[model samples]
Target: MQVNTRSDVGGKAEAMDYTKEAIADPVVERSFRGHKGMVTTAAFSPSMKQLASGAKDGVVMVWNFRPQLRAFRYANSKSSSRSPAGKEAASPVHKVSFSPKGDIVASGGADKAIRLWVPNVVGDCSTLKAHTGAVRDVDFGDGGATLLSASDDKTVKLWDLKKQKFLQTFNGHVNWVRSAKFAPGGAYAASGGDDKTVLVWDMQQKKSVKALKHHTARVNTVAFFPSGNLLAAASDDKSINVWDLRTFELLQHYDVGSVVNEIDVHPTGDFIISAQDDATVKIWDAREGRLFYKLHGHEGKVQTAQFSPHGDFFTTGGGDGQVMVWETKFDRSIASIKKKMAMKEKKAGSNLEEAKPEEVDAKIEEETEAEVEAEVKADAKHEGVGERVQAKKVSISEPAEDAEREVEEAPSSITREPEVNENYTEAAKEEVRPKTAPSASPANPSSSLPSTSVSGEQVMSALGTIVNQMNSLMEVVGRFDMRLETLERRMDALEK
Candidate 1:
């Protein structure tokens, strides 16, 4: 039997007029409605025959898209057994994701727990409780054996699906972690957070390998390209950054004109889609960094958008509590226009002057120097001694003049505390003093005195040296104390 791969849009168009008419009108095949609250997230199953949605009502609904639209509630057996007539989450659900094999689904939310469910099942849901704060997003690894979750607790945790046990916790973001996704092949995972940074974690090493810093506001979402050679980060700064994974360099930057809530890359690796706070979804040509389309239909902010597995359709969920599905139709006219635009850009680039190698190196060096100077100035103005110490540590690799300047501008308290501590001298003297008395001799009358008294000058010199070393050690301890205090405050807040 011959397989039918034709899309819902039919085939290529012959004229631009036909293409324009087709693109202007999008057919909504079906609208699935059951959630009592706003649908915060939605995803298509691996087979594209089902859809899973999560809402603020703390409920997850799975819809069968084939034959007819039927809804199924995913709830824990414990909760169902207690109240069989009711169906609702204990807290708001934030995210829902399907496993690679389509046999399982994971949902996490404000309850600070990840619940696993099998579609069409009424009860017996397994819950994984580890995060201290609201869980923002969850993603399955390539083989579906592991899962990654981002949480407001400022951590991204990895879990083993079979054992249902926590594997590792990635902690570096200073603010809430909003999104996490495993890279292709599952060797690395990328996470974005309210700290305005994107961290790439090495799964095997269990550590963050690279930090991508460009977003000026909270990084709301992150997605890796199909090839995993590039990673995209969307932020509240109204910009999306595409980073080259191999070199850890910024490849392209596209401004979406509003806060981006979520982002997804096309399976074809040719386009990227972003749901914006401005009640619109924007599509961009991923390779060229150019806007491709602006889809507008939602009455409120678009919260999430995703493409289907077959690449024939896409879905968008909004704050208005509506989910709209659109058909993906690539007509000949659209392709021709993109091709011409690419050629035009290539032709125009020859007239531009490109920077030489030396100029590029000089520019990088200048930027580095400016950043260091700004940090030093900021640290000097702040009253926190820990900040100044951190600045000093960062400037250790700078030129002698710069280091000396940092020391001169450092706060008087940090510089004088070591000198005021008399314990260092006393401790050194006590440690160096001998227990036995010296034998008296005719040639050496001074030997009759106690070691502490006879060698007072030597002891004083040793004390001074010990004091200097202790002062250095104290600086390190101060930094550690500052970090410890911050962690204590976080834990206390979580407890409350």
Candidate 2:
């Protein structure tokens, strides 16, 4: 099953921070339209070379990621029940999923059957039939040899694809099961249904282990975070719930205005994408729930949204029968994501030190000098991220000239409150928003993921340097103060 996997750009290099750039004018890079009816689902192959989409017209189409290549589609023939599975659209294909191996594609629809096809080779396919009603969704296991499926028959079924056998029926939902997916580790499975509940199943036992009853309406889809411990469920009730499997804790709950049809966490687990009834696909920061972008291209309601295996691209299926591909620019590939993070760290390091506090020029006066010495000693004695500045004792007999210089500098000591505050605020903002890594700070380089703060090491290092300089000035001040006291004592004794 060989298919063209070429890009239209033809192997040219792009900016390393391509995705970090501001959102493009036209959010959809390419739109693939072949379905006569609404699109139900879209999925990217593990290799990211192909995309498989299912439509309400019953066609399961496989396309090269490039727009130039034609799509290869297979559908069920309605004329004959025994006709070759390589036919035409007979009923709506509600969901399509690519196997982990990227070699096989699974699709389920109103036909009450799930089909596995090697998309590149149209006729080479098999069907697994057990659901008594329409099949709603299908997902591949971690190894791709097993599958989990939800159906209108009010059950989620597990299948052994290698043997083409029905493994077990996970029956807990009292209504139609809409979606089901295997955990990243394959230790558990989750399902959402019209029953208004999300069920977590222990894969080994093939039974529901926990139930989340929060959605006031139907649970449209369920997906597991890459870690396999966090489960996210979208609902017709206009909300998305993320819960931790270990502690059954509600980690995040978002009241999205539109009914969320489906949600997928990025491969990096830093962002989440949602398909909504508002015809908008939203990208969100998984940690903070911050909305990054509300992509608008679909003419009708969006039905399914998924991040590519690499997180560089995402696909959306809409009621307009169009499948849109989005370039996120933020690639989740280990090397690329790591490089992006490294660049962010470097930028933050630069910004944090960009506005360093200049040397604090203090006026030399009796009161001000005393205050300066006391403050310097206090800072020197403290153990902190700042370097331990040590104050040295000066010999009272050392030099009259040095004492005179100390007296001269005393008048220069004035509180630099205004200037210090100016740098403090800028550094503080940079300290809090490291992900913005505003290299204009090129005016604001924000990340789609949760923001990071500047490291304390750099800030402390700067403060340590300032403290060291202040401590040096303190040694001379002590000597000058002793000289004045000695002169006063001699003058008083002579007068007596």
Candidate 3:
């Protein structure tokens, strides 16, 4: 099932260059195999030397990626040893993420609590609890001073990492918030949810400023590009939507023909990798809005895929209880350079073989240079194609013709009807209120009442007003109850 890279040979060469064969495909460099249950999520540290993974068994394991000091699992106590089988049960962990410095790791899951651990520490240093339902995802802020968690309770909460306390809660999605991530500079946060909407929140204002609705099904993941101005979202609708964060405009829509579970943008900002339910990962050229390569390896739904900080490698976790590390072919170019230098040295020491060492070295150098030159030429070709693709404005145009063509050519099972707008009307929008104190009522309420004319529009408007008032009252009540609960917890802490 491997594709041959020899077909795209470059210029004529005196000897057959085997370097191309060495880096033909993105072969698996390693497979992590300790999780007793499905690996729910995995992420590489900023240094790319360590990997943190969370599994259904609630174990958060950090691997050094080297053989000697292999891995350490966080337990309930101050010990890194494996928990006894008959001891306290472990909760299923849904997400694990490393902070920007890679010094801290966060995990959250079915326990409805978020725990923070230092990489080499034995147990969690702190725990934050607020979500009422299963926590679906967790992410660290830019400076690692704050953390964000998404939960099935339909809210995303920001926590102060230093204080280990809840700071603020964002409520916008009407359904479970599946994923939340801090923008590059941490000025804003983006969240996607079962409401089929992507929300960009103003962290300083503590409110949602923009809501981007495009997906037909639940949005599973949202990621901000490295520049922080482009945001990408993947969904169960079999499409990936790229938006310009500054303008909130849809920049590109790639219909992947399968349910996209997750997506990671390369650090170069030129490519995107999407893991799909079809057990395949597709790399797309961001500038061209076209497929660059397809990686096939996973056996079941690929739940997660992440590019290393340096973009030299990428990892994927699947439902089949496998985590695979893949080496990008682009990384091989650098290896080839080193290999070429070594070949020259080897040829110099091989005069006893009866071949002219200098000639052999010259021929090998020529072949190596030719191979590298060929790669450069191929890159130029891709760039030229990208320029042409951009010139056509395929990614920027509304109702992209190229995307439509892809959809038409796709199999029937992969194609579906386009999404229809289902946003609430103006009146319905007014019916929902922010979770804050209610305003004082007017003194002269009779003066605000409409005249006795009873048209259908008037009746509907009156009903909407009543609903809005009810919503405000309910929000007030809920806030009061939450305040009481907070007070109770504080009193208990004081007593302890």
Candidate 4:
């Protein structure tokens, strides 16, 4: 079936599609909406049942990848039994991912924290806080047992999910680390950072394997094909280069004619998807080194694109706040051959019982400990957000109140005390009040409510209405007084 994809501005999300040419096919099956900010990145789970997206609003939302309505829950919102998935509103999440074997997910953000999430759960799976700057990317390693995070702090952190402690920091990147990933074999991991270099690290040795440096500008993304033999790096220099993983040698270089934001190899190893600032996503024949399809529709920069695990569909997220899923015309002829090749690559005479029950228990205990540590970090974050929000509100409403209170108390410099006060205030309220914006209703004497610090802005904006109502009440009172005096004079005359 031919799929048609088109984008239009200021229309309902469903109604925006129109064919650019009469002969073109519609490419989108359905689009889902949930994130309140620009979707920075998205990935399909290995099972293809779920879609995860990270946004600048600090939210990492997981959506059902069904062709019909894909329901999602916000992470920080109240739980509803009717929703297909629960919300764990971790906002401003720069990246989100699912483990290869389980429903667990890892999300990293500008907050310099990494959070792991499990499906049907209400909160984070585990929280790792080691980076001092924004975490640029995160991924699962060692069959989702280990978590790897890259950050602007110029280091990549390896977290032991079982031990619930930071394993080690891969510290060779001279600039901010942009992306990292475990090779499909799980023996080594690759990281690309702002130093215009890619470093491969061996897990057992816990050191750098090789540093691949060729791009003249910052490397934005790096990916290893499922084969783990080929590495592709996208960069700000408008090029995508293929390299041999073992030798770290550049094999093929292709100019994308724009800043390449992300690169992904198809699971079958035949096609490559490169998202670019040119507002188009290009599919290339990875082997032939030629462009196959140029998918153009996004009105803004295309941030990232990936093929579904099944290879039948692909999705793209852009700066326009759109996530689009497209069907492909490619057949399964390549994938079937690769599957046969994979079966042959298994090592001969390996012990099948290497994984034991005790080992599994140990991993669970470690992840549990990591989860506990994450809970403490989340609580601290909740407190920090509350304080910042309160301070912003107080400043916007009446900073003088705090200043006056401070002067009256003759306290030490407020320091971060505003945050402490926010905690106390929330504890006293002990009620989750539904957040409200200023009401749109007009002000009148009949409905006159005294202006509190919170209502000052609303009261000022509606001051004219309040004044008119007060004038009307004064006029009524004036007539009542005159009528009372006249009646008293008439009674006195009658008495005489």
Assess every candidate by TM-score: 0.61, 0.65, 0.61, 0.59
- The count of backbone overlaps in candidate 3 is 0
Pairs in clash, predicted candidate 3? none
Question: Per-residue lDDT of 403-477 in model 3, one digit per residue for the tens?
Answer: 355334323212112111122344344444333345744357663354344357756866775575445334433
lDDT of 4: 0.67
C-alpha RMSD (angstroms) for model 4: 35.5
* Tens digits of lDDT, candidate 1, 1-496: 1211212231211211222323432335666777777778999899887888887766788888776546787642222222245643347788999999988889988878999988865635788989999899999995899999999999999999999999899999999999999999999999999999999999999999999999999999999999999999999999999999999999999977999999999887888889999987777777667776666667788888888876567788878777667775642335566777789898766432364434443544455445554544454345232333233332223454664454455433233233335465566646554565455243666634445544677667776766755565455445533433443343344335
Positional deviation of residue 255's Cα in model 3 after best superposition, in angstroms: 1.1
- Residue 79 C-alpha lDDT in model 2: 24
Clashing pairs in 1: none
On the 0 to 100 scale, the lDDT of residue 400 in model 1 is 48
Tens digit of per-residue lDDT, candidate 4, span 1-496: 1323434322111211122322222266656577677778888888878887877666667777655744555453221223235544343667777787747777788778777777654644667778898888888888777888899999999888877679889889999999998888788888897899988888889999898888888999998888999989889989898899867789999988999988888877877888899888887778778765667767789887878877777778888777777765343534454565566565321322354534533544354334433443444355452221111111111244563453333212212334444464454333222233447554655433433333565445355544643453344334333433443343344335
**Superposed model 2: Cα runs more than 4 Å off:** 1-26, 66-68, 77-89, 330-496
User: Candidate 2: what lDDT?
Assistant: 0.74
Poorest lDDT segment (10 consecutive residues) of candidate 4: 388-397
Ordered list by TM-score, greatest first: 2, 3, 1, 4
- Which segments of model 1 are wrong by more than 4 Å? 1-26, 67-69, 75-89, 121-123, 331-496
